[model samples]
Target chain A: MSADPQRGPLPAWSLPAGETDRIRIATQWPEEVTREWAWGGATGAGVRVCVLDSGVEADHPLVGGLAGAKVISLSPEGEVVVADDSEGDVVGHGTACAGIIRGLAPKVELWSVRVLGAGATGSGPVLMEGLRWAVDQGFDVVNMSLSTTKSQFAGVLHELADSAYFRRTLLVASAHNMPVESYPWRFSSVISVGSHEEEDPFTFYYNPEPPVEFFARGVNLDVAWRGGGRIRATGNSFATPHMAGICALVLSTHRELIPFQLKSVLYLTATNVGGDR
Target chain B: MSEPGRLQAAVAAGVVGSDEAYRALLQSIVEVARAIFGARASSIFLLDETTDELVFEAVAGEGADTLIGTRIPSSTGIAGWVLVTRQPLVLEDVTQDPRFARDVAERTGYVPQGLMSVPLLHEERALGVLNVLDRPQQARFTLEEMDLLGMFANQAAIALDLLQRARRARALVDHNASGDTAAVARLAETIETLEDERRAAGVRLVQALDDILRGA
Candidate 1:
């Protein structure tokens, strides 16, 4: 088949010079960012945190209630499945994530962009659309606990992830539990988290390796379920929300922190880094 | 039987008896490509000339059970891009590029972090796309891998063209040498049986590859 006569060759996918290693650390520790930095008067009051997953059960006591929630499912034909407000959680996954974020940053405005349902599986396009919707809504922090393994959609997801980053909307993604490669967690632009056995919910560690950059507590911990109850589950999925919660707290007080700056701040304040030793 | 040997067997069976054997041969090619790649999933789409769509004829990979009959617009997604451009692509980080279509991945269930795709061309005409999903971790796809996939796609395209021509030959035989209604009916039934075998074999190949790659 012949290529479109009008379309030219795409620009080479390259990074800016000196950005080959994106996550570099500052040699000297900032004295102002102490162990209590996350808890330093910022309750994430003005930041908006969007959970992109199965719809969250907003009425769950731990969640109190969502500031706003929307369902973004697509029909088998890729048509919009619903256009109005959300119907509620199909499973308890979103609720658990919401609970974690709410617990860490109590005053953050919570929103849900439901891209999955009872099957607990969603199409790549639907999830992409949900992420795009969250970004368009100008949410401060978008927590993506789920990811697509379809490589065909990678470029678009990367674009959206970068788009969110440039717009100052922090996208927090989880590394796959199966160890199989997936995205946008693999993208250096977004914050990627993995599960660690640390008991403290707020305790997170910066990885020395590339790809999976951070680890947070994702073991069996009590979290809100769909029926307003609690359940214990473990996966990198759970670890992601803890980081998102902390990010909301950080952004609330430091409104000027872009994704790069926020990540640096996180690296500096990590349990194993800087003065937290 | 060895993969190439199966193709020979299918071809022989198709030429001597009915058209079913040809389909088996085509499906085997798809399976062999999946195994060689150690892919999380793989699919073969045939281009629909009239509608400019790529219709899934065989899918072997994780969660691909329901994707056998799915159709994608020929102008959308990377498959379409590959078909139109007649170029092979190996994307280590698929999301970082702009050419990828997110909607197509959404339809497939899981978005692949890494992908390798090539167009199927025969006689300078684009036939469709052959794509493999995520590779084993720490193993990035290289130019050598892209060339290998392109080679596989070439062989598959030629084999498919042969299958179509064989089916046409059978129809001609029915019209001229074999006027027996019962024999013609039996030939049709045989072809149908062969299609089932082909589909089952393709799925089994993918499942086996998945088990092997996952170290299950």
Candidate 2:
């Protein structure tokens, strides 16, 4: 759920009656498909997925009933504390990804593992600590829509994800949106997801060698927000949710599929690169 | 299924060269034969035009070398029969058949009771034969079974022929790029090992025109 809130509430978002002063979040996903995925299968029901990102607007209408947070832990200095989100979701990137996951996997239980403190920056310790918490908490899927150039931090996330995969939890991380792939995404175990618009989903070949396992819609995407508002999103952060939601959808049907199997199925069922690639 | 599927996969993987693709292709072919038809053993032979003999490209089940470089006249043995007729040939018992040559049995340890061969022809030219040595659990190949085998042959032929042409083109380019006696020897040894996948693109031309060939 990596988005900048400035793009404004997503289109086609309607506020419910008597819900005055509520943030309005809209689906960038086409209504028909969203509605279909919602009604069709598990819709992420009963499955627990983790969203590790910036803080969520507790009062946001678009993410109503879904749960998330910054991992509360004792500081290295032995101080009891929670991640400082001086501006929780003030940018709306985390909110956008959360909305898409909900729209796609409405039935699944979700836990938000907030890591970014402000301006999409978080320490390696904070990010790794967040991942460990999500894994220990046993999430079916963990969507890390934010990553940094920190190689050591990236290694921690990848190793944890590799272990998590064996543990039946899928970990999806973002490739840096800066036009080239950097660490965390460069890590092997992580199912690195990249951003692509609906107009060019097939063209974004996740690096043939390393990182970039899959791609999803990210260009000009709308996400539901608080007070009946939504915002358009761009970049790999925005795209990771699509894969997370898809993981939820698949896990709902194939509860037995471990992370590797889940990754394999997605690669298999996805439009084959045979002729397309 | 995997041989063709994996070949298709490798082509898609853009993994040219290396024996790994060959191993993957062989495993795929065996799996396909067993799954699609209850075959006990199967082997794919490559025609070595320079030696005028068929060499084992892939083999599965018992007596694996039964199809490797087993040579005969162009119109003599069962393989030659396919080359001459450009059609599949079936033999219930090679001993009872008059067309069956006895001398070739010394090279290939296969004592045939039931044999089926589908000519791998692409663009109407014989590439090789796709053969199943024996049926599973005493079952024999039926006419209907052979037809399906024919269909498999048709797809394989087209894919293989395209594969070969691509190989030749690549060899020519490599030959010209590095000229020497050593280069020529290396080229011959490595061209088959250097497989460039042939892309299969669907027709976009149908949508280019307003007129429809078939009414909607």
Candidate 3:
């Protein structure tokens, strides 16, 4: 698995029988693996990160610009429809997440998939539909800053999360703002994030215990609001995009890395896990 | 008694001689917490709402007792972070983390490498923080352990709440009883002073009688 001749060609056949050849390549490039990512060099240049939240205003200055935007809404008769850029931000939550990602990774392709409505609440069916749309669109990283508390939709969300995982789309989900249970952030297939009070915008920590695997600077962060302005906000919702933006950076370089490999790289790059470099 | 029950008893027992039962209970909590988590030290703090300060109620560990009664602003230190945010934290390297204030540990003469702290919350309001410092063998805290400490923090919050209420109730009763005792002591002193005056009068009368009898 080593690219260097001294470490030699660690044979692909040496891996477990069912493992893919990419595993061998990943093993060869251990130097590329890290938990604490440096934001200075990595621009997340080509990676497509989809922000799934309360719609994004494509013209928001902090957002820079979006590569594409979609809005999922429930019709009067309860039909889920994924529409083009006809919709603007309902509550600015999605715009906030998009701005954070843009701050961290300046050149990444941004996609807005609006799931939450004006009240910052959305039905499970609409959430599922929007997530499905994002996954099917083949975005490299999907940032889900929202979650459904309803138990009825857990199975569907779980399935979609697994599908995204298998299809090499990294799902970064936010843990519930409160202590109460919510999904699909709880799903192991998704990277769960929580808020930390770190002052640095780019700094994040890897949680020793998970279900909430990461913590980013979500407390007192200035994020893009709806009216071409910024507002200081705090929540797990804001933290997910930080991870997603970081994921975009990781995926930009390690383009062939799958979900599992990406998670390993994140673990290795975490502030605590990788010796704080 | 259950833990809460015992904690209530310890507080209700009041001061034995010069030592405070509340202090004893707080120390017991720290000792039990340390033993349970295999931590090098443990400490309990109470939020003094009047002063907006976190008062170190009790401490158990090597030289940590010296930190008792230390007051920190409720918005300062790692303990303050837990109190303000109402979130538990487990840090693997206290020195490396910026949020971990070294000054608090310096004052206690114990610098912990790894620590876990949970807010002692009653209802939605945070009462204080319960800290387990320096996991001697482990580098970081596990979720199961953080959960366990959280549960323990809940119980401690309830216990501390009950103890404060009990103290207030006891203070009212003791205030009346002590007031009466002070009144009785004053009366006794007054009677003694009166008796001394009466004796002096008697002595004066005798002197007059003696002068009369002596035909001065």
Candidate 4:
């Protein structure tokens, strides 16, 4: 097959770069925002995080307990339907994401918002409804490891993302694995993440680029799967939850911080920014 | 319908009128992708939206002989997942994973240990999927390889989109042949035999006429 002239040699948002310029903090703050300071001793207690993808397998050993679980689907007439998720994790993707979050912030209140069904497939309308529900419920952090390439959903998703930001609900989205454009990851209001090959779960870097803001460990890690199983997988999908889990930890400690402030704290604590690279 | 008007409709739809050429293009895509990835097999499946099924359009390596035109539910396998989510995926140790849809793989007569699948996307619409199964050396696919596979899928998607348009045009032409548009069908067949440059000129002329007619 002929190469597409538009796409670069590497995947979107995976470009290597030198260290970024550090952000100068005001002298008024006595303590530096180290990783310990950002999430030190924080177990994500009382923080509500929503996994907005396929349903998370209930009682999965690695995932522990969930705060709530809901499934969003379409009716025969093409209307959105929201119901309790009795059937857990049609595919293992959501479970894998939830397990990652659970691993980092063990005490975070995890909620499963099942937007994708079997084979990890669902319509764009269903995805929007799921996100809207999560935002309306005021989850502290919503981990969206999936995105819609359909531009028709962009406007609505953008509005929802902005609304979440204003409501103090941080949306952590994964950049599309392919180089193609997608949302709501591309929106400035949301924190977009990509994968890094590093093994450290906490070793994340800040991208100097605009679209994908961060990269976390997503290559070849053992993740929780459906039927209470575990498997090895890799993608930007898994990286998103690591960021979300970190967000939960930060929110758990500093309850008053808004989305933007929380983002600044993350940048300050990033391995490239504060920790030893 | 007037000759220019009929030709304009065909041209407006971007019908190339060559099913053989489209199949050949897809065949080359699978072969090249298989070779590039050094995989045991590679194949492309076209989504039949009407039936909600995926039809194997082309294959290289294993199952190339009997796999063409095979139909499977578009809601079941890895290809189905890619089609619905419009995302690329990579999996290792497919046999051990319960979510791998082993029944579907068994039906196809080839069960892979590892696989990577990407949606063949035309704009936001997913035309189908391109799957590379079981690379020789490694069980896991790197992020870079997934990007390369996506590039191949893009080209395949464009060709598939054109092929679908051609099919629609053929059906339209056939439906109109019994009526006064018989001459238009004849002209379409004639245009198919023309050299590349002349055929392109004919297409451009038809498009211009279509624009004028639409304006009028």
| Best TM-score among the predictions, by candidate number | 4
From the highest lDDT down, the ranking of the candidates is 4, 1, 3, 2
* Candidate 2 lDDT by residue in tens digits, B35-120: 67666677665555555555556667765545544454332355543443233444444444322324445656555555567666
The CA lDDT at A239 in model 1 is 88
List the DockQ of the predictions in order: 0.02, 0.01, 0.01, 0.20
Writing each residue's lDDT as its tens digit, candidate 2 over A1-277 gives: 3223798544436654544445543323232222233223566777887777655564566665555566444455744355543344432445666787887777777666655431112234566777887888788888887554445565576778778877887888776432223445556667888655464322233345555677776654556543345643335666777878877887786677767656665664454332132
- Please report how far candidate 2 places residue A133 from its true position, in Å: 0.8
What lDDT is reached at residue B68 by model 1?
70
- Candidate 1 CA-lDDT value: 0.71
What does candidate 1's lDDT look like per residue over A17-107, in tens digits?
5554544643343567775664477888999999987678889899989888888766767576646555676545678889999999999
In order of the candidates, what TM-score does chain B achieve? 0.65, 0.62, 0.68, 0.80
> Model 1, stretches more than 4 Å misplaced?
A1-32, A75-77, A118-122, A275-277, B1-216
Cα distance off (Å), candidate 4, residue A230? 2.4
List the pairs of residues colliding in candidate 3. Answer: A1-A10, A1-A28, A34-A268, A34-A269, A35-A268, A35-A269, A35-A270, A36-A269
| TM-scores for all predictions | 0.53, 0.43, 0.52, 0.84
Give the Å shift of residue A125 in candidate 1: 0.8
Query: What is residue B108's positional error in candidate 1, in angstroms?
Result: 28
What's candidate 1's DockQ score?
Answer: 0.02
**Which residue runs does candidate 4 get wrong by more than 4 Å?**
A1-31, A118-122, A177-179, B1-6, B9-15, B99-101, B137-140, B180-182, B194-216
> What is the Cα-based lDDT of residue B32 in candidate 4?
95
The DockQ assigned to candidate 2 is 0.01
TM-score of 1: 0.53
